[model samples]
Target: MSRKIKVLQLQNRYNVNASDLAEQVIQGLPAERFEVTTAFLRGRPGPGEPESRAARSIYFGFSQSDLKGLRLRALWRLYRLWREQRYDVVIAHRFKPMNMLMLLNRCLRIPACIGVQHGIGDFDRAYRRWEARRLLTANWRIVGVSRAVRDYLVGCGAGFDAGNTVQINNAIDIDRAERLQHPREQARSLLGLAREPFIFGAIGRLVPVKGHIHLIEAFAQVQSVYPQAQLAIIGEGRMRAELEAAIARFGLGGKVQLLGAREDALQYVRAFDAFVMPSLSEGLPLALLEGMSGHLPVIGSDIPSLRPILEDCGGRIFPVGDVATLAKQLGAVLNLDAEQRRAEGERAYSYLRGAHAIEDFRLQYLQLIEQSLAAERAAL
Candidate 1:
């Protein structure tokens, strides 16, 4: 019998979507032909660190200085780990891990390297862009979470080999999402939400990119049309104080609530009458997918990353960062009858079932891994 191919998955942090994707990929691989381990490259666990499920897990415990500066020490530690493991293939999530893996791969001729880009418009630095082009060579592949991201990288002169670069949308565990979800009224009761209010909900970090302030502005306009409307943004970030001030400034203190981070936040999505994400940027946002998995009518920024999903799934879209347009969309959605809303939600769920099933995502990655290894052997 052929020996199993040993693999390693690396990410800079543990709680985010990248980690989640890595975990899913690890779990989904064929057990007989693949053996997988996982690692994190940075500081200690945060409040949101996911439960580890890899066959083995490692942490570099990088300090603040290591993360802020050139990260030379971290690189050294990674090099040692790579040397020790001698993995047949290394899969990296996000830029930091990808860049570091490239450096190591170039120096030591790592057998195979795969990088997954999880966000759109994330490369803003000239050096970072240059690095991407420089690092993509033989035995290396970059996977984009959306077609838009792959196109952007290729167009921007990232040296991704045309055959090697690919687009794979993020997938949610549909069964798990369904199991976790509560009925609308029960979910609302869990959150102490009144049954009378029309709740429009969003879940994500409270960062500038999420465009929560704009969502607030739009919700304010929504209130003018439907006084009983309430907006609840779940998740927390650096922008909390700023968003709070804006909510007060707009006199929406009574209608808008920032619920901060909750471990079970996705389960409560059922409480929303409709879901919204006003992100300025994204790469197939998992939050949006989770919302859709709950069969909620979604409203999202009409950027390239989200437009296709919204278009395919029967959801509403507004121009990015446009508060007025978002408000208009929200008002129009509110005008829909109960049957229309249910139809919209059903459409989203149906689209997800066909287009972004977890099994398809896993199969694609497995094929990529096998093909990459085959190419490496052919080159030899």
Candidate 2:
């Protein structure tokens, strides 16, 4: 390669999760090996901002409207941007950029165009079909955060080269998260959470697919068994009103609090006795990993993506959308003796550091880029 691998990261403003992970990866990479620049479909202030500084150029556009209109404007702006700018590689997050990326890469001939799947959640049929077409392109790499996603694409009968897909699980710096364990009492004191409450927390957008509602239902079941419990959900989304209503309907207003996007969430991760993700669909969620890294016992929905991460890590896995099953599992896990839960947490940490190590994952990504770029140069 003649120059540093200049990767142009394309993202939507609403893609808070993907952007956060991308930025962290960029910052975490060896500086001499890469140059990461970003272009946001609609940029706003949120958790993904600070670490995105590695990007030599940052392009911000796109405004949040309903999903459909946002898609339209994103397509137009992206094509224009591709025509105007130059990049060695383009890494896009979300469906919009992926849809037009083929044409843009064809026009620009960027050696690498990688797509990062941030989550396993999806919308209606039209959206799924649209996603398939958006991701179809030659010499493109699709990094599915979970094996389920990689398999989904293959099963859907998309006409792309089968080998083009890669399963790159989302990873985090667990060392930092381990340090977040400053003393459970101290973390609780900082968050003003009850030092004695058996606090359970979920961090992510409170959308339907996130299955926050399901978690709430499970918590309701849990409350019947353990009275000294409270649920703290971190992050905001469209389902705020609905979720708030659910909390009240269950008469859990006092027991449940929707804390929107905490700045010191990792630090506060220590306060929670358990980290719950009742998501219906996911692509190896980062929150689950963070939860495990913080040594919080994980209780995840039993799904392909989730099972691969949580099943054997002393993390309890339950069936997706089966409220009764999730509730049963939740009650059982939450009721474990303190020592048993702590031992489970230790197991989770060891598994996370081994399978989802940041250094290994990052190196894999870098290797992909290097090999791809090398092949391109050889062809040239």
Q: How far is each candidate from the true structure, as Cα RMSD in Å?
A: 2.5, 3.9
Clashing pairs in 1: none
Model 2 weakest lDDT span, ten residues long: 61-70
Query: lDDT tens string, model 2, 29-123?
Result: 56786777776666555553542566464545445562354455556566666566556778777665665575556566777778776555442
lDDT of 2: 0.74
Question: lDDT scores for all predictions?
Answer: 0.85, 0.74
Candidate 2 C-alpha error for residue 156, in Å = 2.1
**Candidate 1 per-residue lDDT over residues 156-225, each given as its tens digit:** 6667656878988788888888888889899888887778888999999999999998999999988977
lDDT of 2 at 352: 87
Candidate 1 yields a Cα-based lDDT of 0.85
